[model samples]
Target chain A: MKKITIDPITRLEGHGKIEIFLNEAGNCEKAYLQIPELRGFEQFSIGRAAEEMPRITTMICGVCPTAHHMAATKALDDLFKVEPTSAAKKIRELMYSAFQAEDHLLHFFFLGGPDFIVGPQAPARERNILGVIAKVGIDTGSKVIEVRKRLRNVLRIIGGKPVMPSAGLPGGVSKGINEEEKQTIIEAGEYAVEFCQFALEFFDDIVLKNKDYVELITGDTYQHRTYYMGLVDKNNKVNFYDGLIRVVDPNGKEFAKFKGQDYLDHIEERVEPWTYVKFSYLKQLGWKGFVDGEQSGVFRVAPLARLNAADGMATPLAQQAYEKMYSVLGGKPVHSTLAYHWARLVEALYASERLLELARDPEITSKDIINLPTETPREGVGVVEAPRGTLIHHYKTDDEGILTDVNLIVATQNNSAAINMSIERAAKSLIKDGEVPNGILNMIEMAFRAYDPCHACATHSLPGRMALDVNVYDTKRKLIKRLQKNSCTTSTSGDGVGEAVSNT
Target chain B: MKTIILGIGNPILSDDGVGIKIAQQIKERNPDLKVVETGGVGINLLDHVIGYDRLIIIDSIKTGDGTIGDIYKLDLDDLDASMDLTPSHGMNIATTLRLGHGLGYDTPAQIRIYAIEILDNTTFRESCTKEIERQIPTIAGKIMREEQLCAIHTLGSPLCQPLQNRPVSKPKPRRAR
Candidate 1:
């Protein structure tokens, strides 16, 4: 049997190492996914002012600041018992949609796009968006920049800034949009919708052209059944901003729909000795281990999980795409996380359609963008569908409006268990005993990047360098292979690279 | 001439956000001073310093021997290989600064940086240790005095003589009921 270990998986957000131990018989014996850093965000926010949750939590992540901001705001709002006005809600939704559009575009094009477009084994120097741009020409790069710029402009109009907008407040937003701003937002929204449509065509062409990737598409093969979780509107349309928590069983059956505050009852965090990040699972399901099986509660989040949870897309084009995806996945739960990119594109289409609706809504032009109350309740929960997955921020406060506790479940946390599973599966299937050819390990790491794990923001750490080390040993306890790579340095852009590779 | 002060640091990461906090304090004293908070070394930095003729950058520097709150007046031209300025972002600050200079948009004519020596950058908790927080007021006061002195010096200089006695406009009063 052979044993292989990859320490500090490269191109990921946080510090983590994966070790795969195989016995003399060449079968997998044990797998360990380790996250080195401890999460102290919850404990640190205990004595802060309740109203500062949004701003404070925004610091949790530079990549997904909007997620932390929205969740923190929502939690504070719940505590305060403040419901923003119609215009306020509309503005918030628009800002969030803009964030979704920008963030998803960043992930799909800059982060995940390279994997599909550029072959995985391409030198570390040629595995970045810049490298892809050099090969593909300026037009593609300009498209991405244009999309991000337009999205940032839209978000700026409402949120006050593009990246970490300071708009959200406890009761409502701090600022309101005037007529001129509204018109600007409307124009930008129209442009975004058009851009998204163009991107859909672009992605469709790419998907059709790549037959190898097409095989990964579910339809009927691979894991296509698992529990689903997300938010929905009263009419059952997909809601990204706010709604009661809903969970559906593997067979498209509704399991539970509970208020956001009630999440504590169903979800319980289980700490594994290997990883610092805790694995949250259904309280009743228990830890059935990482292997795929019934009652595992190993449901994932992201585009795939969101699509599975919702009935249909809010927009027509997205709905059509959703139908196509469902048909391909054999109707419901898409367990194969590899199909997340397809789901992301479909959701991007949906977000564009939703933008058009909001832009057209007459109320969007109104002057009353903020509705804040003088007093608020002592505790609250804010939940939103972040680009990566569902994000929840729970905050409790003292009588004097001081924060007593803060619990955050970021998008990366939602996929914690699923990430481990993907790593294990990829490791077992790809790594042969003491040998994982160069770039094969990179592929396993790519599986984690599919979720775009934001360990920096999730754990409230400033962005830092990441290193991955992999070791392989033979049945005789002889070291066969050892690999060490830095996540940022390996990619040409000094950012994480995502590419697919095949080793013969 | 309008001056923009930028504070770049990770606020939760111990000493990172010190620059921003100092800028905020200076802004409170002089509301006209545009104080902006930024996460260091990115395209965002390029955007922030675009039109500023005079920019004051405040950040935390991990110099081996300097006292925690020691102030330094750095010359942009003198920024050679010897300086130990570390950008809080992934890319090196020197590289980003070089990129900005290469872009040829009017780089800051005079850029001053006040760096605080950092003790710890790993914690997520807010509120710097008492030693660091105490220096905030003194730093703010020093920056304010420097601006006033610079304005006076500029007025007195023969090269910038456009009528030194031009009436100083009074700041708009806060609206009262």
Candidate 2:
């Protein structure tokens, strides 16, 4: 009897390991998705000035600093018991929209696009952005780069920096966009909307049109019936910056809707001994393990969840695209994980439209920003829809305005339980009699990638690149097979990067 | 010739900030060089490094076998074959360079990557390990000498910017992470 361990995985945000345990009869017994936790963020945050949170938290993950910055800013506003002026809120939302547009565009094209555009069965080498360019043409590649540059420029204009935005403050943004900056943002927004529309069309022509790919999207292996969560405006429209946190049942009925401060009342984190990442579940429903369905407490977030938790998109063009997605998918609450890509594009369109609307607002240029806090600092909660999903930042400050305690239930953590469940379900349905099928790794990865889960945010790492490794074991728990990709075993004495090892 | 010096790392991540620290020093010493700092994202790195005739990238890397503060200066040919040229799912620095070349991005023909082996990167700290910190001036000095040699060879060329000697300023806070 032996236990096989695949310690590090590749092609993800952090180290994720998949362990498949076989039964005595050589059939798949169970599977576990384990994530390594980076330690001490909470401890490190203590004693820091509350004002430094936006800057410090953004340093956690280079990928989604904007989300943390926004969440922290909103939390500061709540903590100080101050309300930003109208212009401030609009400007915050404007920067947020740009962030979403840029992030979603990258995820769709560079991160998630290769899977569909290049075909899932394509070799590891070909299943990437270059492969996408080869299929879509080099002109399309240039356009992708061009559009991204413009979007980031808008971010730079608003946030004062691109990668890590510093515009957000306790009651408002640190800076306001003038006419020229507003004009640039508007142009970028228009281009983003057009590009996203084109992206949706491209998905339809390439992925939806192909019967095999469509089957893959609707296939049972990729489907999971789970509760969905997101942030919605008063009218139940998808809102990225500020909104009430909403939860919908598997059947698309509103289960609970509450303000940002009331999250703890609705959600609870479930800890497992095997991993550092905590699984969040509906507090009222209680912890029901990893099982899905109406009774299960495990819930999902990000694009599909957002689409399900809300009534419709706030913008007209996005609303149309949203309706089309639902009609094609056979109605609300799409459980198919593959559909996340489509939903992401739809949201991209919505974000772009929102960016334009905010940019065009007459008061957007007003100097009335930042309402100084007069109340004593205590505890406050702030939530925003990160490009991935609903992100909640809760903080408690001392009387002197120093951070005393901090708790973050990031969007990915909300989907942590469901992500594991999805992976196990895919593994069980696809792996037969201990036989690993072609594209099995991709199948498992597809489950997690849909979430675009940032483990780097949840748990930190060095080199900050995620490595994924999958290990299979026999009934006796003996090591059987290993598959690795984008791994970092390279000798860093600068000879070169590491070679990926794929072995069975 | 037009040249760019880039530093890549999470500045708050202890030893990982070594690259940025060195880049800052180099910027101080050579006011004429186009130096910038960034988190290690391939596409973003590509944006900054493109269109340059030469690029010198300073980064902190973890080589299990290397000692703390050891520096490795490497060229493109020195890298391994598995480092794909196209942008893959998680494109690293090597992949970004390859992608730049593949896309006909006018990528720097003369490029060097100085990887400083680090002992600690997991912790959240503003400073680096003392050992790595000690090497900052030496690394910056080395890079400056290399740039000077290149400038001397390329002097009088229309593409080359004028070289100037000036007193170094105190390091200022970086706007980027």
lDDT of 1 by residue, A1-504 (tens): 011111222232343566666678564455566655534676788877887777777776666778778888778777888778888788788888888877776667655666665545555434445555665667766666667677788877877776567888876787777778777777777777777777667766766467776665432222435677788776556778887667777776777777878888877777777667777676667667665555786666678877777777778877888888778656776677667877887888778678768877888777776556567467788889888788888887888888777777777777788777776666666666545656645666567667776654322221222334555555665656665452323322321221211110
Each candidate's interface RMSD (Å, one decimal) is 14.2, 9.7
DockQ of each: 0.07, 0.15
Going through the candidates in order, state the TM-score of chain A alone for each one. Answer: 0.88, 0.93
Note the residue pairs that clash in candidate 2: A2-A477, A8-A469, A9-A467, A9-A468, A9-A469, A10-A467, A10-A468, A490-A498
TM-score of each: 0.77, 0.88
| Candidate 2 C-alpha lDDT tens digits along B60-146 | 666454556656666665443334312123455655676667667898988877766677776777788888888788767665654
Worst 10-residue lDDT window for candidate 2 chain A reads A1-10
Candidate 1 positional error at A46, Å: 2.5
For model 1, state the Cα shift of residue A399 in Å. Answer: 2.2
Off by over 4 Å in 2: A1-15, A457-464, A486-504, B29-31, B77-90, B101-104, B134-177
Which portions of model 1 miss their true places by more than 4 Å? A1-14, A26-28, A216-225, A328-331, A369-376, A458-467, A471-480, A486-504, B1-7, B16-36, B40-46, B49-120, B127-177
lDDT, model 1, position A308: 73
